[model samples]
Target chain A: MKQVWVFAEHQAGQWTSVTGELLVAARNIADQLNGELNVIVCGDQVEELAATLKQWKVDRVYLSQHPELNFYHPLVYTETIVDLVSEYGCPEMILFGATYLGRDLAPAIAARLGTGCAADCCDLKLDENGNLLQIVPGLGGTIFATIVTPFHRPQVATVKPGMLETLGSSENEDKAKALKPVEVVKVEPRFPQNTAAIQLHSVKQKPAKESGLQAAKRIVAGGAGISGPEGWSLLEELADVLGAAVGATRPAVDEGWASHDLMIGQSGKTVRPELYLGIGISGDMMHTIGIKGKGTLIAINQDPKAAIFKQVDYGIVADYRSILPVLIEEVKRREG
Target chain B: MQPLQIAICVKPVPDPKESTQLQINPTTKTLVRKGIPLVINPMDRNALEAGVKLKEANGGKVTVFSMSPPEGELTMLETLALGADEAILLSDLIFAGGDTLATARVLAAGIKAQGNWDLVICGAESFDGGTAQVGAQLAVLLGTPWITRVSHLKRVDDKHLLVTVEDEVEQRELLVQLPVVLTVESVVNQARPLSLWGIVEARNKKITVYNADTLKLDQKGIGLDGSPTQTRDLFAPDASREAEILTGDSPQQIANQLLDKIGWSRKGAAN
Candidate 1:
């Protein structure tokens, strides 16, 4: 039988939402191809996490646990997956969330396997021949390109997170009860004793208060029109009032007003929030493609003909400087 | 300590500022790059800058490598102007239209033919492709340890270096031995501007050209034939949603209307 594999990603001892999202996406492909849906979960003491995959419509869970697997080591992790593929026959397809780890690991694995990998794919489809068609925004996000590895087996793709829906808990429970018990395949991890090439000295976590842009319910984003640092502060204040996360365009990041992590665009994070407010942004498709959610998009720009206005649900053709303070006060007044 | 041998890999990408002008040719199923001038991928400048700085601080030679068409030699000259002691351009018809894996294979051959090196540096990702795959794949082919999204670096001793890498939720500090591959983030350093003197000196700098025959790469492993992935189709995204522009007498009035449309009230705030 055909096999479809999803690499379950977890961090800080919690299963990332993208892991569930991948499982949901892979399930569709598995069903269409009449294949078994499998998940590979690698970590230290992650038996509980691996077992939970059974409830999420997976046919099997391949667990590789070791002390060295706690944190993601590029070489070790790639070697582990390569060994699995070698032991078991190559699956028809392998999917990963386009997170930092996925971006780092997928290509390495593809190179080792002498195959191809599509990066930051937004959609996956099956061709007539059962090839995985990796869809991604291309030509500065003006077009969608369908990439395919026609002659190669085990077509690989790193899908963008937050762009797909996950199976809900109730749906998962019902499916688990209907399906047969999931098979658990435990594999031992082997590593060379000489890891002195790279030694982990310390890990400092980011402040927990700053939530990821992908998970934010509302996001207040800035662009080049956010002329300087003072402009970012104003946007941040509005975000604080609305309990929203702050996002930025590539230009804003280039101007050094925002960090790269908060950038929302084709090359940065893909966000699907409930509401997205873009201030001083021109709304290049390169930036707009990342806003995949069907949320109310509002743009505040001084130019009446700005392209961003065309893409947004609401546009204010006035200087953000003139409108921000008034809007901030109105929001606070209505709340108080 | 002896000076380090630093090798930097760079690519010439379409100018990102002019991205709106970029288009895909439906017939060819490829990007139309006729008029857009090519510049060094932005983050690769950080990689180049890091190499130059390392050479400036310690006594070392910085060699730049690029796999591009003949037009890329001009971009290589710019690298020479930026303080790379020498540059190598891997250009040939057989080397065109390769994916990241194929591209890495050509680069690995070029680097191997160049002899011993202590370090290899690349931009975390390219501006055009943005695959961020070459550095790690090159490391695998070269049999060296690799780190991506490196934000900081410092030499600890003759054989060890301290590297800071940006992870998903944390920054990791690692101690790595020499002869490592590193893909640096744009925040690693500010690239120095080109100088008139540097431009004049670049004319004297060496830029050696290598081809498939020169590198002795196996047939069916260097270009389009070697590429595993192919573009099957391309189409513009659906842009049918016309925005409803908010009009009002004043900013306050407009704000209230927007809030009303979005169904935002103090008592009903989803937050």
Candidate 2:
């Protein structure tokens, strides 16, 4: 039987949402291919995580416990997984969350195994021949391309968060009964003899600040129409009043007006806030694809005929510079 | 100061703004480019800028390498105008339709043919391919350490470099030695515009073209037939979100109406 594997990612013992998201995708693909779903979690002391995986639809859990893996090392992580794949006769397909670790490790592992890997894929499915079809946005999300690894064994792809919904049994079930029973297996840790070649001196950490774009319920995003760097401050003021995060289009980022982390697009982060307010931004497909919010969309642009109006729940035809201050006042007045 | 020898991999892609003109070949699964104009891929320009600045700071030679069609030589000349000392184009019909892995193989071969390479650089990802695989694959092929999305070169000496890279969550500063492959991030440095004088100087520079045979790569694993991955199909995505445009007289009224539509109450979220 074909085997489907997901490289479950975690940090400091907590599971990342992308891991659950990939589980959903792997489950569907496994069902379609009549394959067994397996998950590999490598970290220091991953017993709790392995136990949690037992409740999911996973059939096997490969846990590699080691101190060196507490934090992800590119060479160490890639070598650990690559060794497992070779020992298990190689799975039919492997999926990874398009997070930093996944992005760094997927290509290297594929290279070591002499296979092909598709990166930042949004969709996956099994073709009639049971080959994996990887769909990714190309040309900055202007067009979508369907990639297939016909000749390569164990086709690999990395999917971004919020792109796929998590799937399993109903939410009412207890943890163990949530899905199928899983067999947990422990694997010996592997390491290069001379690991000192790539020395990891220290990991300087940013303050524990979650990006507003990722955690906020509402987001006020801007684009080139904001004029220049000075415009972002105004948007920031409005976002503060609304208790929302500040997001920007690709142009705003490329122009150096906004930092890259604030960008919302195909090449940037995907967001699903309850309310997405875009001002002075044309609704380019590149930006729109990243916006998968369940709430209302309000597009404010001077061009009444702007493409953004076509995809908005509320369209304000006026200069955002004129509208922002007024909107901030109204929201503040309502708050009072 | 020891002279630095750098090899940069560049790809020529259709102007992303004119992406509306891009088409796909149903049979070959490759891009159909006939009338579309091409330019150096956006991020590759950043890599080139990094290379140029490195050479300028420390006396060295920066060579631009690309595996593309014969027309790519024009783009390489433009790169020379951007500050590369010389340019090499690996072109042949045999190299057409190669995926990232196949593309990286030819690049590794090209970089190997030129002896005494201290560093190799590439863009984090191409705007067209969006795979971001070649640099990592090339690093594996070259048997060297690699880093991607490098935002800045904090310090550089003859044998090592201290670089900062942006990750999904935070910024990480790494101390890596030379004989490394670096895929630079977009925000590393602003790519300087081509100067008129630089363009004139490029007229005297040499652009060496090499066919697949010149690299002496195993012919069986070099091109479309050898590419492990294939395209099943290419098509536009299904439109998922259809929005309704709201009409209001004043900005305040629009804000109030929007707040109501989303069911935001004074107390908290009401949805």
Candidate 3:
């Protein structure tokens, strides 16, 4: 039987969440294909990570220790992974998180091995023949196309966080398999830095708010119907009360009510959060696509027929002007 | 003194929101070539903006290099309408489904086929895959220096150019010498709207399309087979998470309930 590999990604000092997500994915793929799961941790102070992974079904853990590997040098990391995987010969597949480090590291190694890489994939599965099948978005999440590296060995993919279910959804026992521990120790490497000198400077601008859109656990999205800057202020107040992010629709930006960067639609960032609240926003399908990723969506719109209603778990019909500020005050009062 | 000649790369992509269909060859299940209406890549619009701006500022000629089917002609003409001086399309049967690397190869070849260029500016990453590696990979293929995620161009001259990159840490304005490839992100400069007169000119002028044999590309480097990466499978994310709604007699009560869920015990702590 073959094995599957997950590259444990750590940068500076933190073990990225994608590391566990990728490992869970690898474990899943291994289970489906009747293969063993092996995780290769390359960096110092990764001993605890090895044991932690065992709790989640990692059969064998490979720990590579080196001081220089502490900080990422792409060339060094890529070469080390390639060497390790090559020695293992034929792992059914490998997984990496689509973080900056994984994105930088995966392709170079895939190229060296002359294998096909499906980068930034959000999903993966095994075909009837146990070949790795990958699901990656095309045209910027417009279409999810299926691809296969039927001829290649160890099909590799990098996936974003919050997309995959690393652990079993309903499997509560946390049952897993642990095999013999394997470790790799390589010399610290000094590779070339593309830019001549790395420069550092601080911005005089005030620090970012407690919750930016990317960091927010909850988000309240408004649409063009909100009409003016006052609506934004109202939304901000509500967000402050609940500690949520504020998002806008395209029409809001087109009308000069908010910055385009904060717009939620096909053209903007994909946000996934615990709670998504919409106020005065007509649910155009474009805007609706961005909200389904949330835990539960509570949409408020005067237009009962707004497209967003179809996707949300709950809906409210009213003019946002009357509801938002009062809701904020009530929330604040309750907290107080 | 003439400003350096430039060729900008662009492609046609489908809008993500629109339902798109591929023309499939009944026999092989491969995408058929005909009847796919094309639009300029959402990101390449930014590349065209940078190209036109460079031409206008430096008094240089802007030529667009495109790789697509014969329909790619429309994309080039659109770029011309956006103020490009000329446009060329590389339409080779062998150039289909070429991933970033292979796509970069044929594009680099297309530019090389045009003789010499002082600078090549492309959209840092296309919207389709958002790889952003094509610009850097193209630079490697051309054996030139590449600066990516460029948000601003400070100055441009014969010997060198300066641009600001949005590095992970901070704003880095680097003075990279000429004989380099620069990728412009959408944030860099907004592509201008096409004007009536420019549209008329673009419609009237013809675009040149070069096939595989015309470019003399290695057969191994132009199509799906030529690509090092493959599109495995794609499906939407499971947007499912457990949500606990707060129930309270009043708005204030609801707010308090939410604060409790967020693990903040102190009332008024958030404000």
Candidate 4:
């Protein structure tokens, strides 16, 4: 039986949520193919890291250790993954997080290894012929794509976070175990010379007054209809009353009315909050990507055809301008 | 400063905003292109803008190159208007339905035909294909350094330049030298508006069109034959909505109902 492998993602001592998610996917594939599941963790604390994944039903773990890997160097990580995968022989499949580092590093490793790495896959399974069938979003999430790697060693995929739910450990208890040690080629590389047209300075963050959107209990999202920066005072009024963090669409961000961090869409933050209230925004797929997992989504847009309506569980087809003040007043009256 | 030979890859895209009747035959999902309006992919505007900015800073030429179906030349005028020094519409019988890899191969040929230049810039992703893989692939094909998700070009020195990449999970800044390819993220600076002079210049210049023979491209590599993947389908999603209008006898009641619908318990939600 072909084996399954997951590249564990983490920063510092904390493991990434995607690590848990990939384990879920690994468990599913392992159950389906009746295959052994393995994990590869690259960092200084290899033994400790391998021990952490043992409880998750991992059949074996490959720890690639180096003090140099404390921080990410593309080649340092990619080369490590490439060398490890090659040494492990061909597994039926390999999975990684479709995060920022994965986007750049995964495919490059795949290219270097002369294999296909399907990017941003939402699901993965074996086809009738036993080839890997991958599910991915196409054309900016307009639709889903089923990609297949018919001819390759270790069919590869990068899966998105929040796409799968972590299963309870009890259901998958006995199947998980850490593996014996394997050879990890450690390469000490001189950092490449930097030459880009932008400067990345350390940003001084404001002290925690309220939570950022990801951590916020309530979110007030201003849509395109909110107009310019000056018009944001209205949203500010509501956000203040409701103790909510403010968010916006790409258009709102492009208009310079809000900081780029506040924008939520396919190209922006993926937020899961207790309550998400969208004001005057059309719900396009890009915008929808940010708020799907929220507990409740309330949309206020004038256009019936606005894409935001379909995504929001509760939608009001009224002018946000006319309704907002009333809503704000009501919120304020109740707060008092 | 030496002139940077900048090449901008433009794609002729279907205008999705137009009342697009993109209902594919349910069984096959291929786009019904018999009536879709064609325009330059909107993200490509960033490439055009970057090309213009690079030319302004480094005193160089901007070449607008594209491979598309018949009548794709319409965008050449727009490209010229956007300040392309020259426009080469690689419209050949063999270049039809070229996927990203094949298009890159065709584009690589056209780029090679134009001789060496300082840089190549493309949108990190296109609205049409949305693969965002082409720029990286092109860089590999050309054997150059590839930087994806460049949001800003902050500074440029003799052999090095500084750029910021808003990579979401982590924003990074790097300084890289020339002979590198950059994929402009959509979140980057909005494309600058074209001046009237640019429009007039584009109107005045004749767009140069090339066929397969003119570019001397291998027919196999320039079209669908070279593409490793296929678009199994392109169909509008079946819109599904479970809807209810919170009805009330009065406006105040409606506000309360709306709040209730959004899960705002009157007292509990109050700050």
In angstroms, give how far residue B242 of model 1 lies from its true place. 1.4
Error of 2 at B92 (Å): 1.4
Quick one: best lDDT, which candidate? Answer: 1
Best by DockQ: 1
- Which regions of candidate 1 fall more than 4 Å away from where they truly are? A170-181, A192-194, A209-216, A229-245, A259-261, A302-305, A325-336, B248-253, B264-271
Q: Cα deviation in Å at residue B198, candidate 2?
A: 3.6
Q: How does candidate 2 score on lDDT?
A: 0.82
Candidate 4 CAPRI assessment class: acceptable
Query: Cα deviation of A335 in candidate 3 (Å)?
Result: 7.6
RMSD of 1: 2.7
TM, chain A, every candidate:
0.88, 0.90, 0.73, 0.82
Task: Put down candidate 1 lDDT per residue, A1-336, tens digits, no spaces.
Answer: 999999999988877777888888898999999999988889999987677777777998888999888878888888888888988779997899888889888988888888899988887888888999899876576678889998887788898876677667787877777666678899877574445688899999976644478788899999999899998999999998887899999899989999878989777778878889999988777788889767778888989888887788888888888788888888898788
* CAPRI quality band, candidate 1: medium
The TM-score of candidate 4's chain A against the true chain A comes to 0.82
Ranking by lDDT: 1, 2, 4, 3
| Candidate 1 backbone collisions, by pair | none
Per-residue lDDT for B138-257 in model 2, tens only?
888888878887888744568888878755555677778787899998788999998999999999998998778889988766788888777777786565545565568877777777
Question: How should the candidates be ordered by DockQ, best one leading?
Answer: 1, 2, 4, 3
DockQ-superior candidate, 1 or 4: 1
Per model, how many backbone clashes are there? Answer: 0, 0, 17, 23
lDDT of each: 0.86, 0.82, 0.67, 0.69
